[model samples]
Target: MRRPLLSEALLDTIRSRAGGYDASNTFPHEDLADLTAAGYLRAFVPVERGGAGLTLREVAREQMRLAAAAPATALAVNMHLVVTGLAAIQADRGETALDFVLDDAARGEVYAFGNSEAGNDLVMFDSRTRAEPQADGSYRYTGTKIFTSLSPVWTRLATFGRDDTDPDAPLLVHAVVARDAEGIEVLDDWDVLGMRATQSCTTVLTGVRAPADRVHRRLPAGPSGDLFMFSLFAAFEILLAAVYTGIGRRAVELGVAASHRRTSMKNGGRTYAQDPDIRWKVAEAAIVQDGVEIQVESLARDVDELVDHGPLWFPKLVGIKVRAVEGARYVVDQALRVSGGASYGSSGELGRLYRDVLAGIFHPSDEESAHATVANAYLGPLER
Candidate 1:
């Protein structure tokens, strides 16, 4: 957290390049280049591996700070860290490979996702693609993944699929695949209103083979006794909320700067900022943003404290995730209203934030499953 030092200079870089990135609908390659070179992406790897080894709170803070600058790059980097960290843990890839990832992190290598199938919402694990085993322990993977964030730019990817050998296995198989492989096709198909700079596209895999060791198994439950099994979902929710909050904060910051520089049309007010109505709107926006931030941060803080000292409570974490999503929706609505037409324009990061903020309600981590989880915990056994 202290290490990144996200200064005004860093923010200015993001602001300076944001327009160009949004205009091209291209990846925030320049920003990510800075993040990687600065080792921002590797800050969470264990300290034993020479990482900054920040806590969940620290991760959340840095994610928001960077996301405040450019949501697309922040989301891309966050996706990479989540994927690589999951793969790195449990020494899944014979320890040596995971070690290599840590080393790569130390050296500034970033990652991405290649798991969303066309017509398949990433939230459902049952939406598995094909992976057939070969004579070797390895398997040949053939499938097409859509909307893969950071795919074209990142060297590594975490892809989900089903094993042909275990057709009925109640598990989702996640494989760590490289960006460059024979028969792997990257499509230039991502053009959206939000998170446009992520360079998300369709990636087609045609009989690509990777060692079975490269594949990792992700079970339905978190490791037993690990409150984080449920708590991290809360953390993810809070972070998304934080992302929205940061966007709101940036909208205010940009709006304030513009108001001082641009005069109001009504009554020839000295500046848009001086009108009583404009002043009231900005005040209202700040209050709403601050309230949402406090609530989300409190939820995250409570979840962390519970994980460390409170009783093992699953429902609480689920509730936090649900509420965090709610806060995001409210804060984003306020941001758009406060920023006005300027935000909707493609020239600023506010519109990009608008696009990514809506995802808070639908991202696999925050929406539908959470409602069921919380309901099951509080409502008791179901009737047929």
Candidate 2:
């Protein structure tokens, strides 16, 4: 049998720390340190680059396991993985532009996603941030990015902004900026209902410069069929699905255990596990969870194997993400129901899972967007 990416002892340690991190609404600093020491941050970098050299599918599985233990930590680390995974994928296709990302990550640099902007529905295609081209080829970015995960200790931020220097030809300039770069501000505004340990704060860039060497792609704005875009969607959606799937798996496990542990007053003091209604609910949750797990694994494997779904790629990616997140949400809800009032306590694991799972709904390729993508792929663009 293959060695596990995250050993049981390490998982237990991380899991034990999760509640404290959540309760304090603090970043999982210790969890990050442990994962980094284990070389988990470099999972997608090439072996030659001093990394574990794990495949996307392998990393996806590991992420699922990690998320089950400490979801906020996993979700925060997902940003770094997505950046390295994109670089690794590009390198596999003989593109060396993003090799620096892989190199930096392998050398202990933490990368975070800083592309999400308020009111910008055209994610990855356009940006509310302005990227002004400099004479020396570097670009100065100025904008506010919301949900900037790994905000506390990221060394680098993978972000983008629109460069509209020419009125007729606007471009989306993708680049990575050092966290300590001038004019960059991290706001402590990430107190949300769930995923509290992530501390995904707001970032304000006031003419923060991304040096020329770090500027990777400058593509036409408004959704192009670019490989970079495809890589981003693939890495992001698949890994996100993995995290939520792990939550679902944990929910099912908790629900099962809760059923066996809780005794019913009306059923001759028998455990809830012996109740027909509880059994049916658990079975339903498990069934949905099983399907989500299969979908996440299958899609991730296809990405690793370089399966060419072409036009179907976006639809498939979004489909799995939507399914995994929504499925996990349903499973968590069912698990809460199965566990009853005790599970509703703030300190309850089920309650934490319920809150954390809700953050999934806000991730990209949301239900409305996913349905539109699938519809456009199968039915063609609606009369537009």
Winning model by lDDT = 2
How big is the positional error of residue 219 in model 1, measured in Å on the Cα after superposition? 3.4
Where in model 2 is the C-alpha error above 4 Å?
Answer: none
Q: Write the per-residue lDDT of candidate 1 for residues 104-187, one digit (tens) a residue.
A: 666666666676676664443444577776686676678887767786677766666666465455445556676676768888
Whole-model alpha-carbon lDDT for candidate 2:
0.92
Query: For candidate 2, what is the total of clashing residue pairs?
Result: 0
Please give the distance, in angstroms, between residue 323's alpha carbon in candidate 2 and its true position after superposition: 0.2
Report the Cα RMSD per candidate. Answer: 4.2, 0.9
Candidate 2 displacement at residue 120 in angstroms = 0.7
Clashes of each: 0, 0
In terms of lDDT, the poorest run of 10 residues in model 1 is 221-230
